[model samples]
Target: MEALGDRESWAAVVKEEEEEEEEEEEEGDSANNIGDAIASTDDEDALKRRISAHPLYGKLVEMHLDCLKVSVMGDVAGDLDHHETRYQQQPKDCNKYPQKMLHQSDLDHFMEAYCVALSKLREAMEEPQQKSMAFISSMHSQLQEMSAIPIAHSNAPAHPLPPPTSSSGK
Candidate 1:
């Protein structure tokens, strides 16, 4: 019955292989289930993962301290070697700027004046100053500060930015 003994040993090996395969699949399934449960809980963390490694802020507004908004832009634009855009190294004379700067409102009266242009953000995208948290946000996006450029040049191309796309779709 040597053949019968050989058959039994072969069957035992096949059975052991099947059991190991099932165990490995179960471990992979358990990891995926935990990942799915955690994904639904934290959306902001997910968004950050999708965003590109662009600078946290823009570059030009740091060029000088002309207005309250410009001064705030300066802080966001600091530490620039890591950024995508080009910026001038501030001159040693630039360091002579007052250690203390004026409050935003003290620098701009129109911060209160709501012109059709200036007032629109106050009307549309945001609430009135009395209700707004803009001052406390610590940073604002590049688009919000464009209206008050200290100097203007026509050659600056009016190239529209491409619409945003998620990482998966692209």
Candidate 2:
């Protein structure tokens, strides 16, 4: 009877230890999951902030929107031109004459917007071109400096080569 009691106690202790270990593993998994979720959220927010704050990103987005506006304006202008041409071809015939397509005020507005967009695009292009030119100039100067450096060879003369003489006497 005493031996049986000792065996029962040992079994109980073992079961308790297993349950504790399982609970600990579950807790660790939950912590890892929570950490991953937080990290993912942080990364997404950081990306959004970076995109919104980037100088080039804003410029690119503006340019894209301007281009879209310009495209729409061009389409409208084309349609107007077509109508004007048809009207001109048949000015006397009311049936063939084209009706008023777009208001002059609307055209003026779109034109102004188009001009502004073009100006902005040109400005953007100029900045990059200026930077590129400066970079090119710097690189050219560096190359010139590098070329001016005299290289030493084992079997070459210290002085530069003499000018070649004509085969025929001058």
Candidate 3:
């Protein structure tokens, strides 16, 4: 038989095998939701539809983060920069809660969306720069076709006039 090993070596290997899969399983409510969600999925499309339809608290989540940011970053910024200095230097009140923005993952999603929009805009702009009216017209036609389906904010019309403010408005 060629099945020989040192006693210490065999013991060490056995010890490692015993110590495998150390992840603590999350028990209770968290596991319940995950199990239920997975069980409910019929197919890929169904899974996607269910996931998107799952009650999204994105705005509420954003508001909560904004509140936390205001308490933390706001205090720090106030000490670092006075109202006058902040306005003079940055001009935007978004500094009050410096991190009142998307989470890293959310920012990644937003950046992807931004790149898509930017590419479309650049493509549109490139048409006229192509030195051919026909190409420009074709690009313009493609944009018009896209605009017809209408994006979210675009579908909603802006108010014809701005509302009168307390201090000033013509």
Candidate 4:
């Protein structure tokens, strides 16, 4: 009779342990699911922040900026080429004085505007590169500081490890 009671009590304890394990697993799964959902969201700022936190963020940004700079430079080159072509295509004879002067003035103003636009674009590109450089420098310093910390065996003696003994009597 006593053995039967012990068996029943043991069975109840085992069942309770299994229930607790199942609950813990469920909690873990839910937590992982929440993290996944957060990662999949379409928030631009959040994505930028996450990318900026990554180790390769600086390189990625630099490459992207380089591509943009190249594209802008290409555009400027094309515009200049088009302007030159247009100028060459114009008739050299100025039979109509007022019309000739007006066309020349308009062409000069357009060229000036193109130069200003190019300058602005270059300045804009430079600002982001400078900011990214500063950010990358700060991140590198932080990583260095983190690595300098002795996380493991910190409580151990400061003495260096003993040199190994030679296997063959040297």
lDDT of 2 at 140: 100
lDDT of each: 0.46, 0.63, 0.51, 0.64
Instruction: Give the per-residue lDDT of model 1 (tens digit) for 71-128.
Output: 2334563534323234334322322334232233432332233223333432443344
**TM-score for each predicted model, relative to the true structure:** 0.25, 0.29, 0.20, 0.31
For every candidate in turn, the CA RMSD to the true structure comes to: 28.8, 19.5, 26.1, 28.9
Whichever of 3 and 4 has more TM-score, that candidate is 4
**Which runs in model 1 stand beyond 4 Å of their true positions?**
43-170
> Total clashes, candidate 4?
0
Candidate 1 accuracy as lDDT: 0.46
Clash count per candidate: 0, 0, 0, 0
Off by over 4 Å in 4: 1-103, 150-170
Candidate number with the higher lDDT (1 or 4):
4
- Across 37-151, the per-residue lDDT of candidate 4 in tens digits comes to 7777756555454443443333344444444554555577576556555655765443333443334454455445655666567678778878988999999999998778784
For model 2 the local lDDT of residue 30 reads 99
Rank list by TM-score? 4, 2, 1, 3
Q: What is the lDDT of residue 93 in candidate 2?
A: 31
- lDDT for model 4: 0.64
lDDT by residue (1-170, candidate 3, tens digit) is 23455777788888876665332334455688787777766565654533333223233233333333333454664654453344346333333432433234564465556556555555665555555767789999999988787445564665556786797655
* Candidate closest to the true structure, highest TM-score: 4
